[model samples]
Target: MSELAVPAPSRHQLALMIWLAVFPTLTVLNLLLGGWLGDLPVVLRTFVLATIAVPIVVYGIVPRLHRLRARVLRGPHG
Candidate 1:
């Protein structure tokens, strides 16, 4: 099997990537589901948000962000 060697993002970049993925996801989820979540206890609310957010961020957003970063780094020629 062949593998593409992509360099890893630095700590700051990784942090930015995570924030970029997480912030809007949480915001929108909260906006859409706030009333339902608001009735729950704080712990349960946090738990629910984390459960739903993690997968969406990890599987959906992060990969797209990575591809975008790669494309940007590659510039017009690539």
Candidate 2:
């Protein structure tokens, strides 16, 4: 049995990927929350953002990014 070769990203690359994913997530949340977020305390705001962002980044965006990366790497057949 042959396994596909998938190289893991380095620490810096992983950090960059996470930052890329999170920056957009935070931006959208900020836009959606708007003035309402300002009324909440910092901790509450952070909690709320984390709650919403985590699943989106984990289950949603990350998978898509992985698939996209695979497709890109695989070229036409992918």
* lDDT to native, each model: 0.90, 0.80
Worst 10-residue lDDT window, candidate 1: 1-10
TM-score of 2: 0.80
Model 1's alpha-carbon lDDT is 0.90
lDDT tens per residue, model 2, 1-78: 443555666788667777788889999998999588888999999999999999999889877776666666666753
Question: Per-residue alpha-carbon lDDT of model 1 for 1-78, expressed as tens digits?
Answer: 443445778889989999999999999999988999999999999999999999999999999998888777766656
Model 2: weakest 10-residue lDDT segment is 1-10
Candidate 1: count of backbone clashes, pairs at least 3 residues apart or interchain: 0
lDDT of 2: 0.80
